[model samples]
Target: MTIKAGDALPQTTFMIPGDSGPEPRTAEALFKGRTVALFSVPGAFTPTCSARHLPGFIEQAGALKAAGVDLIACTAVNDAFVMGAWSRAAGAEGITMLADGNGDFVRALGLEMDGSKFGLGMRGKRFSMLVEDGVVKILNVEEPGAFEVSSADYLLGQL
Candidate 1:
């Protein structure tokens, strides 16, 4: 089942690239005692994700922080290198780009989707969540091939 509001975020390590090198970050460490906005895309550098979804979040990072969000993160099924490169290309300096390399976190939240037909293999669905102190406040998941619910504008409205 899809994770819902009031659910504590799953404890899973995400491989992320830092200034020094790749590192592991846990969901508990990310969400504990903070209000966070996390959005996930099916894959890195995909059409909608590159042109609209990820850019929107990058542009609105300031506003989100102004609204009291402690962290704004973008995740994808790609590895740390890909995610880091994409973040740099998108000029997403303020947003944290997390690499769900093995899909452990996505699968734990029941958000994994099959994309073998596209030759992309398994991936995370387009989704966003608002978490406060480790508990989810809102979960927005987009329909397949749809961009309505998980957009930054939509999640901003929810906040």
Candidate 2:
């Protein structure tokens, strides 16, 4: 089922590029007692993802914190290495880059998209959510080929 307001996030393991290598992190731990703004994309380094989605969140990250967001993160179906490279390439310092390499999180949320036609396999749909204490407070899922509702500006407006 698509996640909605008031639902606790599914317990799933996600990864980030750690100093030594990829490190595991869980949703429950990530959202415990904090407000998180997490946005997901189909893949890292894609055109819109690199130029628009990622940059928007990075640019607005401080403003989001000022608005009470404890953490801002971006997720993709790629691996931790790629996520780290993309973050470095984009200069996305404050935003955490999460790797859902196996698509477990997106599959659990029923937001996986088949991108085989583009030579990309299963991927997460573009979406963003306000998660507080592991429960969703708001969600903005983008329509196919759309970037409207899930953008940082839109989420800021909601906040």
Candidate 3:
């Protein structure tokens, strides 16, 4: 089942790459005390994700923060190296790129999507959530091939 509003985020560790090296950060640690706007993409550098999903969040990071969000993040079912490279290429300075390597975090939240037919293996569906202090406040999950709700503009209106 998809996670719903009011559910506490799953406790899962993400393999995130920092300037130093790969580091582990738990879901609780990332959202426990912050009002966060987090969006997940199927894969980094994919057409829709690169052209729209991530760039929207990066462009609106300042507005999101101005609306009281503490942090804005982009999560992908990819390794830290790929995520790091994508972040740099996308000019995502205000957004933190999180690597859900091994899909542990995505599976824990019941958001994993099978994409083997597309040669992508398992990946995350396009979605965004507003989380405050460890509890989900709003969740916008996009239907396959659709892009109406999960965009940053929609989330900004929700806030």
Give the candidate number with the greatest lDDT: 2
What are the lDDT figures for the candidates, one per model? 0.90, 0.93, 0.90
RMSD, one per candidate, in order: 0.8, 0.7, 0.8
How big is the positional error of residue 40 in model 3, measured in Å on the Cα after superposition? 0.4
lDDT of 2 by residue, 24-139 (tens): 99888788999999999999999999889999998898899999999999999999999999988999989888899999999988889999999998999999999999999999
Q: Give the worst 10-residue stretch by lDDT in candidate 1.
A: 59-68
Q: Would you estimate the TM-scores of all the predictions? A: 0.97, 0.98, 0.97
At residue 116, candidate 2 shows an lDDT of 90
Segments of candidate 1 deviating more than 4 angstroms: none
Locate the minimum summed-lDDT window of 10 residues in model 2. 1-10
Which candidate ranks first by TM-score, i.e. highest?
2
Writing each residue's lDDT as its tens digit, candidate 1 over 1-159 gives 778898998899998888878899988888899999999999999999999999889888878888889999999999999999998888888888889999988998999999999999999999998989999899999889999899888888877
